[model samples]
Target: MRLRLLVIALLTVSFLGALDNTVVTTALATVAGQLGALEHMSWIVVGYTLASTVLLPVLGKLGDMIGPRPVFLSSLVVFMLASAACGFANSIWWLIASRVVQGMSSAGLQLMSQTIIAHATTPRQRPKYLAVIGAAFPVAILIGPLLGGLITDYWGWPWVFWVNLPVGLVALALASFAVPRIAGGGRARFDIAGTITLTVGLVALVLLAAAPGQGVMDLWMLALAVLALAAFFVVELRVAEPLVDLRHFANRTIGIGIAISAIVGVGLFSITAYLPTYFQMAYRTSATVSGLVPIATVFGMLVSNLGTGWLASRTGHYRPFPIVGTALGAAGLATMAALPVGLPLWVPMAVMAVVGLGTGAFMSLIVAVVQSAAPAGETGAVTSTVNLVRQIGSTLATAVIGGVIAAGVAALLPVGLNAATLTPQVVHAADPALQERIAQIYRDVFAPVFGFLAVTYLIGVVASVLMPRGRLSDSSDVVPAAESVTA
Candidate 1:
């Protein structure tokens, strides 16, 4: 009963963590209106994401050093406080600051969730629970925008933050009572220099991705980011107790696992990244309506993740899922690129469903793959690093594919009067001829983005095929309450 409650609490935290990412996306316009910071809107998201990405590896190391219980509890408390602070913010900058704190704490939430489950369950049993936990991400993302829009419209933007207070409190309570206090062993000293350099590099990279179209400035930023990250690796090698076991990075299982994780990360972003703009521009869907569009993908993901998880648990065979999943994912993305703009809504929904099905199967097994491949003491490190690579991939997709979309849209826009400034309202407000032209422009812009995504998905398929095979190991040394880390 206690374990069940703990699992529930952990899953709740995961849902909340995922919700934070997309919840603010839909609330941006409303929040900007009230705070009058329309120009700085993206910071609300960029700050949280940058902070979260930077912390994943760091906190994973901390979890191993001091034990996860204290770190996890502290994070939960900080998040609760941050949520309350977010609700009472008077300006956009204040809210962004609160989000940064929330991001710091929330960064460890999902990682701890997966790590805890690994502690509690055998590898064979882990997948079913992990798959359910995996489902929370896409589901929360699917509902976040819609939930945010509804709350912002009906209750107010403050309620968006306020809702977290009750759920977080409940999660904190359950975790306190149920989560076992694991004692730390003698892990080597912390690598402060590696941590600092990594932070500088990741923040710069995130800023570059989040910043809009800075030409020469972007090049300089990229160089700094590369230098900082490169220096970080060098520092890690020299450190007594490195942040992670860099030696294991070359292990076929770990290396291939990270490669697969990064590929799927990019593939997933490519397909879903521009959907809202596509819906708004081409179909004239309301923000509320477009927010719900991802639900189709969520549905596909949930079914496949759960089903394959059951099969993997029964058979202890994990390779086939990603292979078939990525191939199908590639095909689905290609289908999406081939879709006509004027097709019935069902067509796009069907394609999204296919894409989601593929991604779900591919994604659910990532942690499992790494955990099975990693040695007893290094599971946390491998898991955290794999997730970090995935984050980097998403950032790369945002930078590269986002640029493609912008340039494609700009070239497609008709000359003379500026079409870039035309909103759906503005376009509809114009004459029929202009409206038709604007609609055609949306269709033209979508093809290149979708085409690029299809190719990315194909690359994912190749990576999946290249995935290294090893016997799935379920011998986790760190069990809750009493287990020890085996070297």
Candidate 2:
């Protein structure tokens, strides 16, 4: 009963985290138009991702030392408050600031949910819970954009953020009642040096990636990001209780899982971010209609996630799923890429559902593999690492594809347009002819950007080939809580 309650709490938390990502996608145009900063709108999404990526490992380790319950509750408080802040934001900067806090909260929610399930349930039960948690992501991903579109089109943009408040409060109330006070080792000493090094390195990398290639020609940003990452590695090797244990990568199955996660992240983020643009440009659909594609994807994920869990339980085998899933994911991506600019309206949506099916088939399988492979105490750290890679993958996709879009815009636009003039305010301030030119450039650039995403999915296909065959139920391997790094 306690475990069941924990599952319910985790599902709610997972939904909140996943919902935020897509909730703003459809509303971004409105936000930009209102704030008069269309050029920087991408950062609103990127900021949350960057914050979440940097903190995932640290938060996971924090959960292991202090216990997942308190950490989770604290994260919920921060997320809910940030949601309120976002709803009330008067400027883009305020919205970005609130998103940063929300992102950090997201990291905690994701890690704690995983840890809570791992600690409370046995391995056999994990697949079912994993299915539920896994479904939350695709479901939220699908709903966020559609909901954002509907709310923005009818009610207003603020409702996007406002919607989270009531849902978060309900989750908080349920968690308070359901969460256990499991005592563990007190708060472990955090690795300050490692934390700073990793944070700086990742932030630098993301910022550099976010910058339009034509805007600043500084290769130094790339160099600095590399240096910071190197420093993090050195600090981690020497720390007594490193936030991320490097030794875990020695496990082949775990390594494969992380690699696959990164590639999948890259593919997933690119598809979601760019698909709406495609629908708007190619199909000339309304924002609400464009947002419906995710619904199709999520519908597929919901079914496949449950099906994967059921199959794993019945067969006591898991490797074949990743192998088949990645292949299908790649095929779906390729199909998306091949879609003619004039393809039937429903074709893309169907393809997205196929892609989601592939995602559902493998999402939990990889997490389960990594968790099963890690020593018990280190589960949080290990789980965090895998998740971190995925976050990094998403960041990279956004940066790279977005950069490509920016570059394409710079080249294609008439001589008058620069970053400043591209702002929605500046664009509106310009003559109608210039606005037409800028709009054309945005449309022209997205096609190739989406093509690049397809390649990333193909890479996932190769990584899936490296996945190891294992079933948790078959092996009674009990990794103590102290040893499992929650990757």
Candidate 3:
């Protein structure tokens, strides 16, 4: 009863955080108008995302140090407070800053749920639980725009943030009552130096990815990000107990799994981040109506997740899924790429369904594989690392795509504007006519962006070759294989 209850509470919190991540997309324009930040609206999402990514690993480590109970509780409090701040924010900067805090706080919630789930369920039952938790992200992606649109249209943008308060309170209540207190028992001093270095490195890397072309920060920022990451690697290797256990990657299965997962992350998140833009630009649909497109993707995810879980249980084979799933993903992406500009709305929606199916079939499988390959105690570090790589992948996809959009916009600049002199902000701030011109340019430029997913999954295909062949039964974390590995 207690375990089940804890899982429910954790799932709720996970859904809330996941919902917050995507729910803002349709609301971005509304937020811009309200906050007078049309030029800087993307960061509202980017800042929260980057902060959440960087802190996930740190919070997981912290959970190992103190107890996940406290960390989780603290996260709820901080997240709620930040949400309130976001609701009442008077300026764009305040909203952005609150999102950063919310991001950092929510990191604990995300990691702890995974940690707790892994800890709570035996290997045999893990796949089902992972599915439940995994469902949150795709569901949120599906629901966010619809919910955000509804709230934004009726109540206003503030309600988007305000909506969290009541749900957060419920999560806090359930967590306090149901979740177990998990502590590391080790008295080793916290590796402050390593922590600081890695945090700096990750922040720099994510910021470099988020920076628009020739923003206030430029080449020097990129260089600094690289240097900090190098320093982080050095410090982690030398530390007696580093925050991120680099040793986990020494296992071939784990290392390859992380790489594949990261690539998957890049593909999945980029599609979610930009699909709305495609709808708005090409189809000329209202945000609410455009949101319905992702439903096809969500439906694909839902069916694939349930189906994959059943297949993994029956066939007892795991490797074939990722292998086949990536191929499907590549195919879907290629199909999407082939769609003509301003193609009928139904076409890309169909393509997105295929992409979601591929993603659903593969994603949780990777998480299960990586976790199963790692030792129990190292779960926090390993889980966080995989998620970190995924977040980095997400950041990279957005950055690269954003760069493409900027370059496309620059190339199509009208006769009066100087391409060399223009900043992204300047381009955005231009009159409605210029904005329309840029939008048309971006729509054309982004068509081939789907090909990037094809490339990403091609790498996944090669990585799948490196995957060990095992029946899902043998791969069972939830249940033992019907036939033994030795057999």
Candidate 4:
């Protein structure tokens, strides 16, 4: 019963954090209109993403230094408060500021939830629980836009933020009772220099990827990211207690796990971000119906995630799941790339389900692999590092994919067909000939994007092939060192 409550609490928190990533997406237009900041609407989402991405490692390190429970609870409190602030904001800047704070707290919630689970469960038992927690993200992504649209339509756009208050309170209550107090590593000193350099690098890199226009600014951001990251590496090497221990990457299992995590991120985000747009533009589906299209993918993910977790936990050897998964994902993506736009919707849905099956296999296993190999004391840091890499991968891929679509549309669309104004309504209301041309443009543009995603999954297959084979440890409290874990 107690274990059930803990898992419930963790799942709720995970959903809350992940949901915010996409929930506001559908509400952006409503928000911009009401808040009178049409030009700055993107900042509402960008602010949250930036804060959360930059804070992952910082919060993870804090969890390792002072234990996860307190960090978890503190983050929940801040998240709830910021959620309220977001709901009540009368101006766009206020809402954006509140979202940034909410995002910072969300980083802690996301990182500590995983860390707490890692601390609470053994390697052998971790997969199943992590599987449950892992499902929250895709589930949240699946519902976020739909839910946001409903709330924005029925109540108001603010309700989207307000809704978190109730859910967060419930999670807080359960977590307060169910989470065990785990001790942290005794070290209290923080690597200020390392944090600064890393933050600078990550911010620059993320901005560069997410930047709207290209040229001089992009070059400057790239140079700044490169220099700051180089400095971060040097600082980590010299620091007594680094923010991110550079040595973890030297471990074969850890390295492979991180690599696969990034690839999975690229594949997952690139598909989810663009598919709805494709449906709306090509199929002329309603936003609500378009949002529902990914249900097939999420369903496949949930089924495979749970099954793989159960099987891995039972057998102890976990190496085969990702290998099989990545191959399936590659084939599925290749099929999707080749699919005709005129085909029945169910056909593409089926293909995405196959992609989801491949994705779900990796969701929990990579975390388990990394946590299993990390020192018990450094579990939080290592877990956060892997998650951070995944976030970076997703962010970069989404931006690149967006660029691909934008460039393709620009070249293909006739003169005066402004891409920015080509909403579903506009496309559907156009003359049949124009509609056909627009749909064809989407088909041509997205085919290559799908191909790019398939290539990523192929890379995942290679990484999975190189992964060191080993059985997960059975002891609940012991994390074997990297060398000891290798068979």
Candidate 5:
């Protein structure tokens, strides 16, 4: 019972972190209008993502150095304080700054939550727990926009940030009482140089991907990212205790799991990011209604996520899930690509469910594979690396897909129709013929993008097939760091 409570606390923290990533998305226009920074509104989302993503490995390594319990509890405290700051902010800049701190703290919460779970459970019991935890992310993603809209309408935009406080307080109390104190390995040398280079490289790379213009500045950013990343690798090789153990990539199971994780990130983000807008433009649905449309996909993900985890734990066989999942995902995406524009809404919803099913199969299983393959005392590092790769993949997908849609609209839209200024209201206000034309342009653009995503899933299927054949250990022994905890 105590163990279950600990898991609940960890999941609550994880869910809160993930929810903030997207919850403000629907309320952005409202925030900008009142806060008076219409041009920089996107930063509200980007700032949080950028801060959290860049610090993932840092926080993970800290968990390994000092202990996950202290880091976890400290993060909960900081996250709540930051949330309060965000809620009380008087300007957009203040809120963005607060959100950056929130993101930094969230990085700890997310990384330590998973690290604690890996320590608290044996390899055999890990899958089911991870599966339950994994469901929080997709659930958060699915409902974030809907919840944001409702909160903004009824209470106000500040309530979006305020909402985290109550949930966070509950999580903090449970964690303080229920979480075990895991000891870290004896003090290791901190890799300051490697950390610096990696942070620079990631910041540059993410900026390059997120930037709207493809100018000389972008080229410079790309070059800087490349040079910084190359320097980071060199530093990691020379450092006494590197932030990330690069050698982990040489292990077959770990390498393959990371590759599949990237693919899953790309597919998952591409669908979730675009579908709501697609519904708005293509079906003329309101934002709230469009947000609800993705529930089909979320439903499928929940069912498959729980089922696959249970089966993996019961049978002790895991390799086949991703292989089957990716194949199903590819088939489903291919069907969606070929779907006609005029089909009833149910048709696309059904297809997205298949993609979600495939995606869910990969979620918890990939983490299990990578962590199971880690050398004792290195689970935190390995887990953080997998998450980092997945996040990078998602960032790249967002950039690439955005470029594709922009280019397609620019080419297909009639003269005088500015793709940059196009919105659902603009389209609705336009003549009927123009609206139909805009809809068809989106259909043409998105179809090819979906087909491209399907091809990526096929590649994932190939990667999954290359994964080592084995059953995860059923041992009750915990990781070295948590061996002292009797519970």
Candidate 6:
């Protein structure tokens, strides 16, 4: 009963965190107008996302040192407090600051939950459970925009922040009652320099990716980010209690698996993050209706994620799923890239379902593969690194894929047109002839973006193809095949 309750609480927290990550997006314009911070509106979401991304590895290390229960509880408190502050904020910068705190603490909730899940289940059982957690991300995304819009339209933008309070409090209470306390080790010490360098490096990189432009990053900022990352690598190698511990990568399976995870992240996030825009611009769907597009992806994730986990648990093999999933993901993306505009709505949804199924299967398998390979006490580190790579992947995808789309749209626009013409309001407000022309431009912009993503999926296919034909151990913490050999 405790275990079941614990898992449920953790899932709720994770689901809520994932929901928060996306929920505010639909409410951005409303927030700017109401708060009178129109100029700084983008920072509301950007600051939160930046803070969250930079802290994943740091919190994972904290969980390793001070125990996940304490870390999780602290994070919940911080997140709840910040959520309340967000609700009452009078200015845009104030709300953005509160969200930054919320984001950092929520990062703690996310990683600690994953770490707890890893510790809670055996290798064979791990995938099945993690798939449920993995499915939470897309599921939250499926619900976020519609929910955010409804709340903002009916009550107000403040309700968007208030929404997290109830869910946060409940998850906190259940977690306190149900989670077992696993205290930190006696000898663990934080690598402060490593953490600082890495965070700075990542923030710089993500900002460069996020810089406003088409198909370009600021050269000076890019240089600084590169230099910081290089310094981070050097620092990691020399530090006694290193942040990431590159030693783990000595295992071929783990090294390759992390690489594939990053690439898959590029493919997964590029679609999920931008496809809603495609719906609004090309199909002229309302914010609420545009959200429905991701439901197909969520459905695909539900089916394949659970199926992959159950199969791996039963059969004790994981390699085959990645091989098949990545190949199929490539195929699905290619088909979507080829699909012309104005088919039945189901056509794109069906393609998204295929892509989601493939990626879901990949998500299910990769967590187990890496966790299964972890040395008993350092599972947190390994899990953190995998997540770290994946986030960095999202960062790269957001920058590169976002840039590609912007560039594509810029190139396709009429002589007098600007990229702003594709905005939901702009597109909707235009004359019928202009709207159709813009919609055609949107279709053209997205086709190449889909093709670009298809190439990434193909890259994933190659990585999956090269995956060693190893099976997961069907027992708890028994040495994984790759780890046993390397160790």
Best by TM-score, which number? 5
The order of the candidates by TM-score, greatest first, is 5, 4, 1, 6, 3, 2
lDDT tens per residue, model 6, 155-181: 998999899998888998898887666
The lDDT values for all models are 0.77, 0.76, 0.76, 0.87, 0.85, 0.80
Better of 2 and 5 by lDDT: 5
Clashes of each: 0, 28, 12, 0, 0, 0
- For model 5, the stretches where C-alpha displacement exceeds 4 angstroms are 283-288, 429-433, 479-487
lDDT of 3 by residue, 318-399 (tens): 7787788788888888887767655678888888888888878877767777777777665667788888898888887878
Cα deviation of 232 in candidate 5 (Å)?
0.7
Give a tens-digit lDDT track for model 5, residues 1-487: 7788888898898899889877888888998889889998888878888898899999888888877889889989999999999989889999999989998899889888888888887777778889888888878877887899899999999999999999999999998877778877656688899889999999988888887586999989889989999999999888778899999899999999999988877987756778888877876667766666578888888889989999988888999999999998899889988886767778888888998899888888789878889975777788899889999899989898988888987898888888889898898788888777888888888889889999999999999999999998988787433236422
> Global lDDT for candidate 4?
0.87
Model 6 is weakest, by summed lDDT over 10 consecutive residues, at 478-487
Ranking by lDDT: 4, 5, 6, 1, 3, 2
Candidate 2 Cα outliers beyond 4 Å, as residue runs = 28-43, 90-92, 149-159, 185-188, 214-218, 279-294, 405-455, 474-487
Q: Which tens-of-lDDT digit does each residue in 356-390 have in candidate 1?
A: 88888868687787776666455566778888888
Error of 5 at 296 (Å): 1.5
Strongest candidate by lDDT: 4
Give the TM-score of each candidate.
Answer: 0.93, 0.83, 0.85, 0.94, 0.95, 0.91
Runs of candidate 1 exceeding 4 Å displacement? 283-292, 429-437, 470-487
Clashing pairs in 4: none
Against the correct fold, how does model 5 do in TM-score?
Answer: 0.95
lDDT score at residue 342, model 3, on the 0-100 scale: 57
Q: Which segments of model 6 are wrong by more than 4 Å?
A: 214-217, 280-290, 422-440, 476-487
